[model samples]
Target: MSTTDVLVVGAGPAGLACAATVLEHSDLSVVVLDAGHGPGGQYWRQPAPASGPGALDGAELADLHHDRGTFVELVRRVEQGRAEGRLEIRSEQHVWSVVPDGERYAAHTVDRSGGPGREAGSTTRARAVLVATGAYDRALPFPGWDLPGVMTVGGLQALLKAGGVRAGQRVAIGGTGPFLLPVAAGLARRGSTIVGVYEANRPGGWLREGRAVVRNPAKLGEGAGYAATMLRHRVPVRTGRMIVSAHGTDRVEAVTVARLDRAGHPVPGSEQRVAVDAVGVGWGFTPQLDLAVTLGVDLTTDLAGTPVVGVDDLQRTSRPRVYAAGEVCGVGGAALAVAEGRLAAAGIVADLSAHGMPGASVARDRREVARLRAFADAILRAHPVPAGWADRLEDDTILCRCEEVRCATVRSAIDELGATDARQVKQLTRTGMGWCQGRVCGYAAALLSSGRPGPAVERLISAPVPLGALAAQPTSEPHVE
Candidate 1:
């Protein structure tokens, strides 16, 4: 087992920024552990050598907008540190659990081969841990959502960023948030015939948050650029509408789009069927907080209806010696993530400075954090989840696809089976025991099973253990003597 002064648990912007900053000032060693083969998280993903641009799907194309240069430089810095024997970058490693022991912590991880591949796997210990595991695109299932061609907006972006692929020749990008516009336009630019853009909120909804956007001119300009691209492609942006259902025999061949009322409920006679090969849909992001929550960090509900690790101005959590940044704190975009990461590193440095090491330039880093946080707040307030979103779901429809648990089963688990918490519901109905280990289905399960209470909700929920632990362990075979 190896040990380091600080261990950053993700290769995303937040993790990398923290690692780079720590390496800049102190003799304290830093190590980065990530499951991705490359430095980029889902956003700045790069293709494997065997993977080609043609292999990219619609989702992959959308990830191209990520600032690859920043990630590249991070990898370069890590490599330099490695050459100097000051950094250890463990790629394709999936961390299972992080348990605190005294002033240090132990992190368990398996090799990328998921235990079956021919690789050495081991665990490591660190003095302090930085959780930068980014958020996941929430999967809200509708009728026919289980069809093969349906995917989340983030999934499409991952395919493109990692493999230079697109989802299909004809595709529809439908969802809420500023993420979809760029995703749709990116896919369209890559030769995909985007059928329509369906958004649950109307244009006027954004007007309510105009002051927020005005405060962040760069964000405004970014949105304007995405809008301009969609306009150029004539993609027919439909606001206040949502995909009620996707219809197809083998794969998604058509979708039923409907205009919603002010309450975001479907309006009668407003439904229209549009033929399409694929539909990329998502409501928004939810923090990937299994590690943070598992470590007993205090979790709070954000405006996006997700649980994020609560942190102070220094990014320190309720747990001493633990810090969080990036989407783990909330679903702020990469710029905000980078800003938080830098501030977190500075904070760590300051805490370590009592030993005579000069910490990160405090005044400068605070200014950077303040600027980015203002922008993040603006973005969050502008994109609050529409009310009564669960109203769009049908009872028989699947809510947790990982375990084939339907909404009806979830309702039964709560209403009939006396299941008061997400764990009990999952135990009774297998709602969150899927491949993703409840990352995809946990939020929906909690909300459907209960009213999704705040700190109380956390008590009711039992997040799945990281699946990386269950990989087949290689053992010494018996000698046939």
Candidate 2:
């Protein structure tokens, strides 16, 4: 069986930081597995490999100055680690299932190369596993969210950051929180003629977060930079506003934006129709904890009422051999994720260093991680998914885009069918049973039906695998190379 001392899942800030630190301090071999073809996770998604470190234009630099140095250093660290033979990065390999066997972990992976067939199936055994799968954008369903050219604000940033793709020629960026500011600035940098920037939170809401900003001057500077970029580009940022509906024939051509009340419902006679080629919208992020959940790790509720990986001071999960960091731990940004990754690496190194290896001390790292986590918590408080935003969704609006299930069906299932939870609603109307396997529709369904976040549906595999691949594998033996 192919074995390693540590296995880091994910290639973003957290995973990169974890793998890099472990290789730097210890003599253990580590394998870094990620589904993506490239590194940097989502925050500093690198440009094409050919472009390397010389591809940043003036606008790109302005939009990404917050962690440009971190991104560059991470890339260089990965390059050096691979050269030293202490780190092996298996990119384009999707880790579907990670299970505990004896005293170690068996991570079943499928390489999405050479046709993504049964031939690429294998498992890696590791003494400890670190999950830093990061997060995805969470957008509540609106009247016309299903339309083409309607995407999350993060989607816009991903396109631009990863491949220099613009959001659209003329786009209206509307959402809550500081994330929207970055997306708008990124799209503007990519030459997208932004229609407007809409935020649902009350103006001057960050005054409540004054202490956090005071403590973290870097974070305050980043926010000011984004604001300056938008101002220089003549972008008007409207507060307490949201996109009600995106209108178009085949693609979004315009959006109906409305000033939201304190409850996040549309204000009477306060709607404006802006012509645009696309609409970018999102409220916040949901931690990608499918792997942690599948591994039976304990979950904690975040400020947004979503289940995140429960971790202690050292980023150790309920499961002893499994540690978690980054957004999977919680939707903190790149800096916090990097800090948590380093902390988790320290815990892993200390726990696994019984065989003539030196133990690691995390005292200094713990203090830094705590400070960064506090800033992240303050950011979460500053930009909550406004209460009652779902109340604005029309009864006829489609809730599950995969199944075309409408809001009325979910409401009826909850009110008329005596449904008390999301699973019951899902069974009654098939609200979350679709191609996405409830990843997209689960939160909306739960919020509309029940008050709290729904229970995690036990999933055996985090991602889809070919049926032939599993069927052809030996049931008793580890297929390791």
Candidate 3:
């Protein structure tokens, strides 16, 4: 087993920033393990490597990302730290569990970098552990949502960013929040015909949070740029509208768009049929808390009522020597994540080093986090999940695609089986006892039964592992710092 002064569980903006800060502020050794093949996480995901070396260049993928400069700088610092032997990064390593070992923590990981003679499972013990696992796309169910061409907006973005592939020639983007804008704009730029951009919430709600809007001028500029792109591509940006249902035989060939009432229900007379080969939908994000829950960290709800890891201003979790940053704290953007990460690193430095982080730097990062988080709250308020979303579910609509649990089964569990929460529903109807372990269907299930998002389900294994890997785990105790 390997040991380190600090172990970061992600290489996203938050993890990268935290590693860089720790290296610059202290002499401690750091190791970063990420499931991604490289750094940048989902926000700045790079394209897959070309068949030959130097075939794909940064210039080719530049337009696919936002805030490239920040990603570049963080990567540079991480590379420098690795070169000087102050840091190590294990890419394509999925850390499944973290357990308390005396005064330290032991992280169990499975190597996912498929190749010849790869170690299946291993453990690394660290003095301090920081989880920046980030969030994933939260999708709600509707008729034909399980169709072949239906996908989350994040998935569509991933396809374009990671593989330079457009989801379809004709794409209809539907969702709430500012995310749809960028996805629509990117696909439009990539030579896809955007049928329309359907947003369930009206942007006028931002007027209520005028102070936050003024505080983040950069966000406004970003929005303005996307607006320009939409106008340039002639992509229709319709507010107070949502895609109620997708329609097709074997794949999605059209969608039903409906204007939403004040209560977020669809207006019966306002439905319109739009033709599209691909449909992308989203309802904000759910913070990834699998490892955090396993570590027994405190949990709380964010502004959107999504469960997130609870942390102090310095990003310290309830568990001693444990910290969490980025979307795990809340579903803010990358800038806020970076601030929180740097702050978490500062907390670690203060706790572990003889010389703690400078007061001025800590204070500055705190202020930045506060400002960015406020803007994030504003965004959440502006784009809440439509209250009547579940009301539109048909009896045959698939709720859990993995197990083919339909809306009727879920409703039966709730109304007839005395299931008041997702857990009870799962026990009664097998709603979440599938391969995904409720990651995709948990949010919708909770909302349907309990009227709120469910708590993160605790699991010893965060991701699926090969049985051979489990058998190959070493019996020796991991060395502690």
TM-score top scorer? 3
- Per-model CA lDDT versus the true structure: 0.75, 0.81, 0.91
Please give the lDDT score at residue 292 for candidate 1: 83
How close is every model to the real structure, measured as TM-score?
0.88, 0.93, 0.97
Candidate 2, 1-481: lDDT as tens digits: 4689999999999999888888766777889998875777788775544455656543454355456788778768878989987788977778998888777889888777455453366788899999999988887898888888999888888777766777589989887878888888877876788889988887667788777778789887988898899988889899888888888889888999888887777887998999998788987787887788778899988776678898987789999879999988778788889888888887787778743223334776677777777777877777776675775688899998888899998888989998888799889998888888787788778777787668767777888887766664447664322
Poorest 10 consecutive residues by lDDT, candidate 3: 48-57
- Candidate 3 stretches greater than 4 Å from native: 53-59, 115-119, 477-481
TM-score computed on alpha carbons, candidate 3 = 0.97
> In model 2, how large is the Cα lDDT of residue 298?
95
Candidate 3 collision pairs? none
Top candidate when judged by lDDT against the true structure: 3
Residue 164's lDDT within candidate 3 is 76
- Number of clashing residue pairs in every model? 16, 1, 0
RMSD of 3: 1.9
